[model samples]
Target: MDYLEYDDYTPGNETENINITTEVTFRGSKSSLSHVLVAFNIIILVVGLGGNSLVIWICGWKMKRTVTTTWYTSLAISDFLFCAFLPLEVFYMITSHWPFGLFLCKLTSSALFLNMYSNVFLLVLISADRCVMIYFPVWSHNHRTVRKALGGIALVWFLSALLTLPSLIFRQTTAHGLVTQCFTSYAGHSTHKAVVVTRFVCGFLIPFLVIVFCSSTLCVKLRRLTIKSSKPYKVMAALILSFFFCWVPYHSFVLLESDVKNHSLDLLQTGLKVGATLAAANSFVSPILYVFIGNDFKQVLKRSLTSRMEEAMAEDLRTIGLSRSKSKSVEMI
Candidate 1:
């Protein structure tokens, strides 16, 4: 669930001069923003976490025998985990204090960034899978094994973790009088700027570019298909739209932040703050828009959980209830 953002120690970053002159208000560093952000983020977090959790439970429980569902289930688990920690942001937004000390401050903030990276990485992987399957159908027919995709996804997670290592290296709690700010601690001022630049490129710019490229190409190719419409294409379209919806704001904010840095625009500070809060909300958007609403995600989720008990009586008839002796038995059966 942690989106994999770049590490904060990439070099040439303007960490020293990065401090705002009364731009960011906290309960000292982020206080006033917290009030609004806390309410919004907390609400989003509740919805996203709850929804994604259900998706994960269902996918893992009901579709455990399948491959794509397994990847999606893992994705849900990651995203939901991030949602679970959002209350911390909400709590800090209300009280404006990072009482958890340096360790937690760094870990929590870094975790959020990591989740961001993970989310994007997962999306990119999904897009790639779609493209590969379409372009090489015959090959995919032979090689598109659930086990193979799962292994690939596992590799994505590992690389995402590696890429986010910089966050853990740089995140820290900086207390200035009444406010305790959570931020990255690059080795040098230049390094901070480098970190930000790298983040803009690797996390936002590159991933966005890849998503757009892959999805667009896939869309064009799919459109040309003379074959009848299948359920998978619809799923592919939903996935792309979901990726676009959740991530646009976050990346846009990065660009806006770059532009707004030390500028004296009309509604400068307030605008930047508002934009940042919007960016944060991007973290929760996809879970609401995509995973919850797409295809039969809801039906699948319901079937995964309480459906078992309701249908337990009919267990003898058949697991799917469609026909007897269709699919083999599954799970704790």
Candidate 2:
């Protein structure tokens, strides 16, 4: 997905005084960069589409339903859908043209944002669920059910879509000479600033904070339990670190874009492109991370897809089954 800055261009006699020395150099560098980015996107599309689709099938169809499966299934769906749209983006990037027109421009952009917001929030939910299960096992046993998880997933999807409305509303395709570009446009400077601020806060900062708090609290609780195996903690740390590593650069570039002066425009643009690529890479990285988290390295190397999924859902099955037995005993009392 391309993140574009829509700046108004005005032609006047003052244009004659503007320096054009770096124009040719920037153009050459940008062309090479674009090719590299397009190739990277192609790789991401192939790997992400295949990996996430496997996760969806395993979680949704092959495995028994549970809260963990439900959450993961949703995550897989989002990543798969985002990767599905990458072909169109790859084509646009390769040709430097937007042949798909306005509706698709809006649709793809909205879908990207939808995946981003939904994935982060779902992670927060997962972290919170883990924390609750560990700290308040009794309450978790009584209340954490597949039905409740499904309901929460539905709500997260709705909120993600709602947050993506601005992208759908403002994204447009404009043709300048031979090149057609897809970008987000706002009616005024204030509107643009508001959109950027909203994205930074709602899309990045708040969810990140929630993940950190939940993870830190969960870490302390897990330490108190004197658990011998550090595997689960390591997996949690990887997930948290991956999320920030993938997103922070993109958001930082976005914020920096607004403040950059004219002389730094080329550098800022290149940075933004790199940031966007890193962010998009998250779709593929996440599924791989989940697989690693589910299985030991040797198991991952040896297991078939079905067995891998079964292994992934093993803990969920045990947890749910244990909760049911506990609840039944409490009811009998």
Candidate 2, after superposition: displacement of residue 187 in Å? 0.7
Q: How many times do residue backbones clash in model 1? A: 28
Residue 140 shift from truth in candidate 2, angstroms: 0.4
- The lDDT leader among the candidates is 2
- lDDT of the candidates, in the order given: 0.61, 0.73
- Candidate 1: which stretches are off by over 4 Å? 1-16, 19-34, 175-180, 226-231, 255-262, 265-272, 290-293, 302-333
lDDT tens readout by residue for model 2, 118-145: 9888988888888898999999999999
Best by TM-score: 2
Error of 2 at 26 (Å): 13
Evaluated against the true structure, the overall lDDT of model 2 is 0.73
Candidate 1 on 1-333: residue-level lDDT in tens? 111122222334434334321122223234555466556776778777777766666667655456567667767777776777677766665675666777766566665567667777777877788788889999988888988878887887787788777777776666769767665545653555566677667776788788888888987897888765455555655655655565566555544544443444434444544554554565566555444455566556556557677677578556557543444344326
Cα lDDT over the full model 1: 0.61
Give the clash count for each candidate.
28, 0
